[model samples]
Target: MSRPFLKMNGLGNDFVVVEARSKPFAPSAEDVRAIADRERGVGCDQLVSIEPSARADAAVRFWNADGEEVGACGNASRCVGWLLMEASGRDEAVIETRAGLLKATRAGERRVSVDMGEPGLRWDQIPLAEEMDTKGIELQVGPIDAPHLHTPGCVSMGNPHVVFFVPDAEAAPVREVGPLIEHHPLFPEGVNVGFAQIKARDRIRLRVWERGAGLTRACGTGACAALVAAARRGLTDRKATLELDGGELVIEWREADGHVIMTGPAEVDFTGTLP
Candidate 1:
């Protein structure tokens, strides 16, 4: 049997979107690995499946290129919102996920604005093994005596993340310390590592080392996490522009709603049939 799929990219973090509303198929790790293979398959950072929702909108399931299931994916959610709007002829949706429900609306022809809900900041919510006094904790990336980086604020946007504010995004040792901080002992389930360079109070540059997925072009959740971590530490304002490798995302932690609103573009690269 052949299944139709859409190739989409949310600020360069590409995804393979599959609609599983009618016919059901559970994608395995091997299946995801094959489909995400750059040379052999469609090649994407994540695979997104759209299923029937218990709420008014649809439900989304996110799978990494490695085929591991994830609690949430901000990019994939916007892509799913795009698909739902196209199929149902609606301009808005309230999609559901393991993390929580999100409200998505059409910002422009190709852009979607999503209310990503409140971020979790408590050490328990971030789910570190032990409690730390301050939101930021010191984790040695290289050597015990002299480490590469230390004292990163931890935040959870459905997934765990550690943000390191640096003087320069280019100079930050992402290649050397990303892998180390990703598997730091404090994070039992591991974490996404972000290096952020604040360009201004409202603009910042970011690079991420995702947990299941390595250094992707961009990570929406990682961007939100970075803004939250920075705002809490007084490094940046409540709202900021997160300039990622692929493109830029406008993120606002609204004081009125206390929900993080992420506005960005989602593109359909192509469509293919799964055989």
Candidate 2:
């Protein structure tokens, strides 16, 4: 049987979205991997499914290329939100995920602003291996006297993230050091690694090594986490623009509601049926 699917992207973080609202479509880990394969199947960073929801407009799930199902994916959420709005002819859409319920609103032409919810600042909320100051955890890479990366700020934007403030994001050894920190014992559930370079009080350059997807052009939650971590460290303002490899995202940690807002663009690549 063939299943209809949508090929979409937020920034450059792409996804293959399968709708399961009317029919149950659950793909196993191996099935997800096969469909996400670059050559054999429709390639994507993550595979998304839109299912029925009672508490919200829809229920969504995310699976990385490695076939690991995750709680939330910022970029994928935007694409889903867009799909919902386009289908129902509404300006706003709500989605339920493993992370929690999220709201998405159209932000100008071809852009979406998603309320990512409050970041988890506590040690247990981030659920690290043990307790540590989230503002600047006690971890590093390289020599003790002079480590290449150290004292990173941790935050949970529906997912665990460790952000290291580097002088140059482009110069950071993402491929070399990303995997080491991802599977490190400190993060019990694994972690997304962000190498951020603060360009100004309102701008940042970021590169992320996704927990299960490796390095990619963009990471939505990674961008949100970077802004939160940067603000906690006093390196940048509470609201800033994160320039990712694919594009840029505007993130704001609202003081009043304490919710994080991530604004960016989502695009359609092409659509086809999966055999």
Candidate 3:
């Protein structure tokens, strides 16, 4: 038998969303990889499953293309939130995840805004191997005397991330250095790597190497992490527009409530069925 699914993308970070409320859909690591394979099956950066939830409108799960289950995905949450609102004819929806409950609302037209909750700045929360200054931790790459990348700010927006401030995001060696830092011994659970160029107090150019997914067009949580890291380091304001390869995302770290709001577009590419 086959199952109905939706192909969705947020800033070109695409996903294959499966509604499993009626019937449970549990795919193993191999199954996840196969479904994410561009040549053989439905291709996506991550696989999203929406199931019944008692605490929120629905419960969502995320699996990377490499097949590892993760706590949260900001882009997927926005996409799922849009789906729920459209189905219920409501403006807001709450989606639960392993990370926590996320609240999303329709920002405009095809845009959605999600409250990604407060970021985790403590080293233990980011779960670094040992306690250290999250603002530019002790790590480096390339020549010892003149490292290519070093002292990146760390933060956890549902997942781990390390942001490296660069003079030029486009020129940064994301592909070469991303994997090296992702598997760095300091981050016990691994981490997403972000290269950010501060364009202004309110703007930034960003790129991310997502954990397990490698390089994606955009990474919602990575954007949030970058903003928080920047603000903590006094590099940018609490709110900034992050320009990604696929598009742009507006991120606001609200001071009053200590919640990070992310607004972006979600597109329904097409609908299909699982083989």
CA lDDT scores, all candidates in order = 0.87, 0.95, 0.96
Error of 1 at 91 (Å): 2.3
Write model 2 residue lDDT over 174-204, tens digit each, in one string.
Answer: 9999999999999999999999999999999
Per-residue accuracy of model 1 over 38-83 as CA lDDT, tens digit each: 9999898998888887685778889888888888888888888877
State how far residue 190 of model 1 sits from its true place (Å): 1.5
Local accuracy of candidate 3 as per-residue lDDT tens digits, 1-275: 79999999999999999999999999999999999999998999999999999999999999999999999899999999999999999999999999999999999998999999999999999979999999989998889999888899999998999999999999999999999999999999999999999999999999999999999999999999999999999999999999999999999999999999999998999999999
Per-candidate TM-scores read 0.96, 0.99, 0.99
How accurate locally is residue 245 in candidate 1, as Cα lDDT from 0 to 100? 96
Flag clash pairs in model 3: none
